[model samples]
Target: MLSDLPIRKIIHVDMDAFYASVAQLDNPELKGKAIAVGGCETRGVISAASYEARKFGVKSAMSGNLAIKLCPELIFVKTNFERYKEISKRIRKIFLDYTDLVEPLSLDEAYLDVTKNKKGNPSASLIAQEIRERIFNEVGLTASAGISINKFIAKVASDYNKPNGQKTVNPEEVLSFLEHLDIRKFYGVGKVTAEKMYQKGIFTGLDLKSKSLDFLETHFGKSGRYYYHVVRGIHTSEVKPNRIRKSLAAERTFSENLSSEVFMLEKLNHIAEEVSKRLSKSKVAGKTITLKIKYSDFSLQTRSKTLPYYINDKDLIFKTAQDLLYQEQLNNSVRLLGISLSNLNTETKKTPEKESVSVQLKFGF
Candidate 1:
């Protein structure tokens, strides 16, 4: 029955602790040390943590203060997005040699559909290996890859062997592999969803597979059908080359909370400039402008204005943001301020449907 399903070779490549790794790569003195990229001891969040720091429970998105508590010796490094983008481009150049059907999820990870690749390589596993090798030798960073029949499984398998490792789930292995997977490990299942799944007695893929579509849909709503198909190894989503940019935003977290709108004007201007620059670089305009405000008490508020026409000019963005800022009275002392432009003018590219190929057992690594 599984053999009747269509199969496409997909590879998910993820750079290992990309930001932290780049910091270590550039400064050999930081190698093998517990380090985190981004954030400070007092006022921000860690962007990425090295393996050494992970041993101490330090991780990305963690409060810098909390990370310090976890590992007092953790060295904090500032983020250099420009440097990361430079290296990411080099890695992407390598990917272009294999297939144009590459979908970049971020600067550090991407999904590559190499079923009909430029290199004419039949073994996706070999392509993944070669790609990882090139990234390390040429870019001075380690990457992990997951190769499988579809993007979903490939993404999951990539984490199986990480930080300079690769895992391949052959066509024949997809079922058993997913069947044994923990419910928490499913790609879309977050903490809340996992807890909900646990409540439904779905502890593993096998348990998920045992539930009927009606049961899943009844409980999980629209997501139930997705779970029904994916567990049987049926994910047809293609790797899109041109992923649309839904929004462009820039934000700043202040070291000290500001009590008045008078002080925020300058900060909001700077953020608007940044957002405008990003919009210009992306060569897109937006009709919607959103103002994000985070209060000292951790409360959040957003104000949005959608214009009839798209605009990306800094002055226009700033004016819109300024309008939103004064549109309401100060909720509380503000700790963070942001501006984002959405409802972009950029059009989404549609990928033409291709004929499905019968599943074939392939070489595994």
Candidate 2:
């Protein structure tokens, strides 16, 4: 029955502690030391942590103060987005040598469909290894990879190994592998969802499989159907090469919270200008404008207005954001403000699905 399903060779390549590793690579003094890519001792959040930092419970999205409490020796480095983008371009060049069917998830990772690669290699495992090696040798960075019959499995498998390793889940091993997988390891399942699943006695993929479709749907809503299929080795998401940009945004976290909307106009104008620059760079415009406000207490609020037509001008964006700012009274002192444009003009027409073909379980590696 598994052999009857369509199969595609997919590889998910993830750079190992990308931001932190890049810092180490550029500065010899940071090598093998506990380091974070962003944040500071008093304010902000850690963007990425090194393996050394991870050993001490330091992690991304953690408050800098908390991270310091976890690892007192943690070294915080400034983020260099331009440098990261430069390295990412080099890595992407290597991927293109293997296949044009590359879908980049971020500057640090991407999904590549190598079923019919330019290398003429039937072994997806070998392709993944070569890609990782190339990334290390050419970009001065280590990467990990997961190779499987589908994107979902490939993404999950990629994390099984870390720093500089690879894992391949052959078509035949998909069921056994997923069955034993921890419920929390499912890519889309977050802490909240996992806890909910645990309450329902679904701790592993096998347990999840035991629940009837109706039972799962009754409990999990739309996600229930997704969980039902993935465990059975049945994910059909294609690797889309040119993923569209959904939104453009710019935001700032103030060092001091402002109590009045009058003081936010300058900040809003600057943010709008930044958003406009990004929109122009992406060559896209949007109909929806959103204002995001984060209070001093960390509470968040959003106000949105969908225009009659798309816009990308700074003045227009600032005016919309200005209108939104006064639309509601101040809930609390605002610490952060952002402007985003969505419902983009770049939205693509849906393409017809390609015909699925039967694939035999013959992994060359």
Candidate 3:
């Protein structure tokens, strides 16, 4: 499959600790501090913790209260998704200038197919370097990039050098790199799956490649084909444009702490307007509305309501958030407000057969 596909240069650019890093960028004072962005309350969880917080054992999805206890000096900041998205758009513009083959994994990362280039740069590695430099120079932020013949290796290469660095894996070096890599680092190999593979003596990519396709298929069921292909670095992932508007979400961080219901509701209105504009721009409608609030204590809460029919109008989103706001009994002062619309029903044909296959969640959130 890979041989039939384009022999292109693929680059994976991933931002390190994206949310926390964005916070640091906006507020220079947060630099070098152990920072957490998410819910601050005992019941809330950390969305993104800086490396400093990670050093103190704080991590994403971990309970906020536990994170604070582990590192009492942890500084909590609410998420500002709107600002992040704006910055993401500017970065994406840079990618499109290089090539139209830009597939966004999220606001923080993307895969670029630059086999045929606009710049006519001799090497993909050099292109990646330029892209990283451009992001830093224009956005005042650092990004790590990976370069390789295929997507899988390129994704891995990006992580080889973390936090403002780049790595490349040429065709000759691929096998040796896989040989020394721990099984956990292999794409799609999670803890449970790695343990199972270990039990089967599949400890490395070389070992994994050695297994019979039938044996892998019989043991792993449908995922065997994927295992067989990935071990040999046969990645069929494509870099396609992400223009669909399945959902639009916006959030903001307060300059100061806030606990008032009136103040928080007002912030929700602004975010609702942003979401509404995005939905209108995409010419889409949504069936579900969600409200996200983060308190000064770092507690986060979300309330969602699905309508009987689809709607994308701003007033409707605002009203939905207002209802969810009233439900919050003022347990904490909200430091951030977010509005999201989901269950989008765009004006398009039924999902194409090719697109119907559920892509594995090995990467891209």
Winning model by TM-score: 2
| Per-residue alpha-carbon lDDT of candidate 3 for residues 1-365, written as tens digits (9 for 90 to 100) | 43344345789999888999999989999999999998674546688999889999999978777999999999989879799999999999999888877889889999988776698775788888899899889998889998876778888888888988998877556667777777778877888989999999988888888899999999888988888887776776666665455677888767666767778777888888888898888788888898887777767788899999888788888998899888758667776788888888863535332221222222111
Q: In model 2, which residue pairs have backbone atoms overlapping below 3 Å?
A: none
Candidate 1 residue-wise lDDT, 111-169, digit = tens: 99888889888889999999999998898899999999889999998998987999999
Candidate 2 lDDT over 1-365, as tens digits, reads 56777789999999999999999999989999999988888767789999999999999978787999999998999999999999999999999999988999999999998888899998999999988888888889999999999999999999999979999998888999999999999999999999999999999999998999999899999999999999998898888887878888989877678987778999999999999999999889999999999887778899999999999999999999999999989889988899999999988546445445446766664
How well does candidate 2 score on lDDT at residue 267?
Answer: 93
lDDT (Cα, 0-100) at 252 in candidate 2: 82
lDDT of 2 at 163: 72
Clashes of 3: 9
Query: In terms of lDDT, which candidate is stronger, 2 or 3?
Result: 2
> Which is the winner by TM-score between candidate 1 and candidate 3?
1
**lDDT of each candidate versus the true structure:** 0.91, 0.91, 0.80
Rank all candidate structures by their TM-score, best first, as comma-separated numbers.
Answer: 2, 1, 3
Q: What C-alpha lDDT does candidate 3 achieve relative to the native structure?
A: 0.80
